[model samples]
Target: MLSYGVSKSSSRVPHIVTFCCNNPHHPTTTHAESHSVVTRRALSLLATATASVFSVPVLVSSSSVRYLEAAAAASTPRFSELPESGGVKALDLRVGDGDYPVNGDQVAIHYYGRLAAKQGWRFDSTYDHKDETGEPIPFIFILGSGKVIAGIETAVRSMKVGGIRRVIIPPSQGYQNMDQEPVPPNFFDRQRLFTTIFNPTRLANGEGSTLGIIIFDIELVSLKHL
Candidate 1:
């Protein structure tokens, strides 16, 4: 019976040792290893996803910037070109030619601004006129100070007092790169995307817009030479 008891104790001791070897600390170490591996993989995947998302907009913006640069280069010649008009006979007034001084000068005139394609008056001081049958509107401007647009300054200088002339101003000369108020968003965007920004007056409100021409029927009221 003593030998049998000793054998039983030896067998029990082996089992206890095996149980200690497989205890919580060993399992906890395995779990920690597994958790670390999973966390690393998840972080890698999140970084990849973030990079993929940001790359698309970056590519799009880059392409847009390139396209705009190319378009601006191509449209360079349009500015120096002469303007054409129908229905309203255009008067020959070349920019930077004749008495139209580029300096600051006070000028008074009757004028109207209209969209050439739409054939509608966009702005006119003619509304105050009690008589509407082919009458001129009254306006005053200080040239080069930006009381008016570049094209208007050019046109006003070409005309003598009481000379009725239809002057066509291309986008390059008029509001080049400047956004005029009351224009549609789509129109403004199209203009801005393609047009060169030019503010002869250097006003803060000047922004680029569509490639339309401005027709000015001008009568020079006065010129204050600077």
Candidate 2:
């Protein structure tokens, strides 16, 4: 028979081991083999625990990275270029629920006009009436009648009542070249819109040199047949 007793050693860190055997006739493990077995078991347990601890953090990090990528994709603003060569690039912010307006149909709208900028300052709005028209007074106009610029007219033609759109009007659809002679009665009364919606400040401040592209946030309020 063989057995081990608990005993204290001089070292502060103590390693304890206990073993017992009922029959001495059968061969038993040597101290080196016993220690080897214990060491292997401890190493296996440590490997399992380390893998378990580190695996959670790696999985969590991967999941967080995927979540952030999805969020960024969803939150990014969408801007589309027009398929046609000459048309304006219209971006629908909110699609309207009612029907679109036709040519000569009287349309009521509220709009905010601004120079396209990262921090675009509002040049004019129906909400504030920069040109002497009463604020919030809906601008009533006949569609497709040369009553407005080509970009605005094209945008409203596709909009339903209550829809909001942002249209980028190129110089061809906006103020003509300043160096060139004044155009004939073509696009509607630029003077009237100037007095109502557009702020002449850009021209006054000499910021309207080429007057390249203008941006309008327009909402269709109502439509009436002529």
Candidate 3:
């Protein structure tokens, strides 16, 4: 009868030991010697398996690091370009529900106006328009009536109610030739500075003639068909 038992070796390694009172073996080996050889072989296999198990985590750890680095690079925002529409580039920050406004519709909006030439100098914002009670006042106008700048009107016409959009207006589609009402608080002062730098020679030469290039973050609050 052969029985198997677990025993610890001098090296403190655990392995399976076979015990046999009388067992067939090589002519040079006794039953006890065969048991010892079997135990050593078992220990070697277990040690190799233990090493293999620990090595897996090292490979997974390196792979996980690479995955995290790729995720971080993908998360970085890029603003080198934007979609253009009829020479006026527009980017929708939030898409709204409901029907789109059309010509003759009474539309209400809020906006933050900035000058591109002044490194995005904020000139005005509807958020600043407040009543005596401190409630916000939205700017209202009739669509397609030329009540606002052409670029803003064009951008709004393409938006749905409650949508928010950011537009970049070139000088041709901006405040050129228009002393738009509800002007900036420092419009006159800005005009004085603008006049000093206004160059007709550059204007005719197709250079930087007009400093009217502006940016606007506009949100269409609501609209009513008139």
Candidate 4:
């Protein structure tokens, strides 16, 4: 399984075993042959330590090895594609407890919005918007209010408080056809951007019609029942 660790600089990084097998007792033939005698000795020591932890003898079978690999794969993040929503996909970076928000519930979130067309160009980020005391200002809206884009609202509907998700939104569910209120705290710039996207001439030429895929890294900070 993946182990996330924070460094002194507060950067998150994964620490994983040297091999996917992760069985010190039975090293893969390829790796075993390449390693020096000293490395083999180290693996032997690790096997001894592992045995001490579990009194039962560890049997390495093909089925057991496959199970271990599958378990490790499950620990990694994978996108769950939503059907009938124009190919919208969401990957939960952090899953939270509690019930998901329903209609009319007020939800607040901090998000990093990027555009797939422009090489993941970050269009906006709530983290960049800070209060006077220096706290990031979350964007809040009532669920199903239609104030925000469809993709964002759809993803938030399934998120619980403290859950973080990365959503991929196709143009159809984004700013292609409908008009949405400008997102704060850069309302003016966002308004201008949306206005351009909604322009008749631009839409006709397919210039801004395909708003391109939008990538949102959204954190459901909190929710309140209406």
Encode model 3's per-residue lDDT on 105-129: one tens digit a residue.
Answer: 9999888877776677767777877
**All candidates' lDDT scores?**
0.43, 0.58, 0.63, 0.67
Candidate 3: residue 225 lDDT (0-100)? 90
Runs of candidate 3 with Cα error greater than 4 angstroms are 1-85, 185-210
Q: Candidate 4 residues 107-127, lDDT tens each?
A: 998898877756766678888
**180, model 4: CA deviation in Å?**
0.9
Q: Model 2 off-target regions past 4 Å?
A: 1-62, 82-87, 117-119, 130-135, 177-210
Model 1 poorest 10 in a row by lDDT: 10-19
The RMSD of every model to the true structure, in order and in angstroms, is 29.7, 23.9, 23.0, 9.9
Q: For residue 6, what is the lDDT in candidate 3?
A: 40
* lDDT, ranked from best to worst: 4, 3, 2, 1
Ranking under TM-score, best-scoring first?
Answer: 4, 3, 2, 1
Q: lDDT per residue, candidate 1, 1-226, as tens digits? A: 0001123222110011112335666534434544444444433333333111221112123344354344434433322223331222345332222354346666666554565534543444342343466554355566656545666666555455545556666666655433432222345543542332333332344433333555555555555566
- The alpha-carbon deviation from the true structure for residue 50 of candidate 1, after best TM-score superposition, in angstroms, is 68
Tens-place lDDT digits, model 2, residues 1-226: 0111333331121232334455576445556455545544433333333111221112123344354344435544565655552657877877889989999899998787665532454555666533555435666788877747677777888889999888887767764433221122223433433432234676576655334467788889999998
Residue pairs clashing, model 4: none
Q: What would the TM-scores of all predictions be?
A: 0.37, 0.54, 0.58, 0.60
If both were scored by lDDT, which would come out higher, candidate 2 or candidate 3? 3
Q: Given candidate 4, what's the lDDT at residue 171?
A: 77
